[model samples]
Target: MSVKENCQKIEERILKACQRSGRKREEVVLLAASKTQPVEKILQAYYCGIRYFGENRVQEGIEKIEALKDYKDIHWHLIGGLQTNKVKYAVKYFEMIHSIDREELVDEIEKRASKMNKIQEGLIEVNFGEESKYGVKEENLKKLFEYILTKEHIKILGLMAIPPYFENPEDVRPFFRKLRQLKEDLEKDFNVKLPHLSMGMSHDFEVAIEEGATIVRIGTALFGERI
Candidate 1:
């Protein structure tokens, strides 16, 4: 599908999901996951009014950032695994690091940010279900959050989760719902402001939005399957 067509279809899904959940369509944010996609496709997305772009690798995202940083005000999100050694490039280029859950890595990011004199915007990746790709385990999230908050060079904006994907998108609702509730519980019980829920993907974003996902990472739905 063309960029315009993908954008239209995604918008329809967002709107339909919002309506289904009794929320406004404008409230949900669509982040086009552009891993392996070229700058030209991103330009196409920009033409279709996509402002947020997500990349899954630091090296690949840096390439895209260099190619199109001047072309648009695109917010680059690091949606893949982030290592401590690569914190320098990540801190310099990414607007948000979406997979941050380990305390040791968080320390490294803070140290690197301190050296660079920058406070990086980052999210706490949580293992919301049986799928354990790259997030901190559920029980350790609170302690990790408390420890990271003490660091001046790193700010915890919200949470990110990759709920286990089922062949049927409807089966994905429970995970999204759990993530939303987890954020709410963390805020109320822990007395912290976590307004963002960075969950959902191409196949099940509508379910994510219905469960209150502010940022949806979608790639295949926008740019087709990755090579």
Candidate 2:
């Protein structure tokens, strides 16, 4: 199927999942994970009513963002590892960063964003799967949240996670539930409202939606397999 048809199918699934979970379709943002996808494909998805696009690398995203600069109302999100050196470009191009896993990275982003005079919106990526993964552990989340609040240039939107891949999408539900619960606990503990839960991907987004995913990062399902 074409990108538009894939997007339509994904939207239909998202809507059905939302209805099943007693949530509105608008509550979840379907971010087309455009990493490695061509600008033409991204444009196709955009024309099909997808306004949010996510990229996994700084330089690639920069190219796409620069090329698509004329497309108004497009929200770009960085959904991969953000290097300290590349912080400057990532801050300038992407509206949201979803893989903030450490305090040092946050510091770099804050410094760059401060210089750019931009308030960088971000999500705290948590590793609910394995210890070797690239995400903040659940235990250290509070400390990270406190530290981020002390900075002036960044705001934590919510939590994101790439759970262990499973053949059955149903198996990924726990990680989604855990991320949602973590969001809830953090909000109550810090008295802060985290409005975005950037979980889910092409393989398991429907389950992620049922578990309170405010933003689902869909790639292969939207743009076909990455090239």
Candidate 3:
């Protein structure tokens, strides 16, 4: 399928999923996960009405920005494991960082955003159970939420997670459920209004939305298999 056709397919899927889940079509935001994808693919999606794109690496996203700067109004989001040392480049490129789960990374982002005179929004990534991942464990959310409240430059927008992918996406339900529960628990305990849940990807986005995902990072489904 052509790039425009690819984007349309994804949009149709989103619209159907929203209707199934009893959500408004506009409620869920589709983020193009253009990690290794070329600028042409991104531009095609943009032309087709996709305004947000996500990258898993700072360097790759910066390269995309340099190549596609002419396409203004695109919202870039960082949805990968963020290194503290690479915070500045990330701050300069991504409007939102969705995988921030540590204080060091948050501190670096805050420092960079302050120096750059910008308020960078961030999502706290929670691992829920998979110990082999990069997100903050579910148990530490309260403390993290409290600390995020004190940060000035980086606004705590919501939570993001990458549950261990199972062959059948249904196996990942427990993980997504935990994330949704954590969001509710955190909001009940603290007065934080975490409105966004950046969960789901190419494989299990439908499940993610039914579980309350506001942002779905889709790549392969929209751009074909990555090389």
Best by lDDT: 2
- lDDT (0-100) at residue 106 of candidate 2? 93
Please write out the lDDT profile of model 1 over residues 125-226, one tens digit for every residue: 988545548898878888888888788998887899997869998898888887777778788877988878998899888888988999999899988878
lDDT of 1 at 51: 91
Give TM per candidate. Answer: 0.95, 0.98, 0.96
RMSD of each: 1.3, 0.9, 1.2
Residue 169 displacement (Å), model 3: 1.9
Q: Candidate 2 local accuracy as lDDT? A: 0.93
* TM-score (C-alpha) between model 3 and the true structure: 0.96
lDDT of candidate 1 vs native?
Answer: 0.87
**How do the residues 1-227 of candidate 2 rate in per-residue lDDT, one tens digit apiece?**
99989988998999999999999999999999999999999999999999999999999999999999999899999999878999999998899999998989999999999999999999999987597678998989889999999999999989989999999999989889999999999999999899999888999999999999999999999888879
Report the lDDT tens digits of candidate 3 across residue range 1-227.
88788888878888888888899988999999998998888888898999999999999999999888887888999998999889999999889999889888878888999999999998999986777889888888778778878889988888999988898988987788888888888888987688999998988998888888999999998888995
- Assess candidate 2 and give its TM-score to the true structure: 0.98
Poorest stretch of ten by lDDT in candidate 2? 127-136
**What is the Cα-based lDDT of residue 110 in candidate 2?**
93
In model 2, the number of clashes is: 0
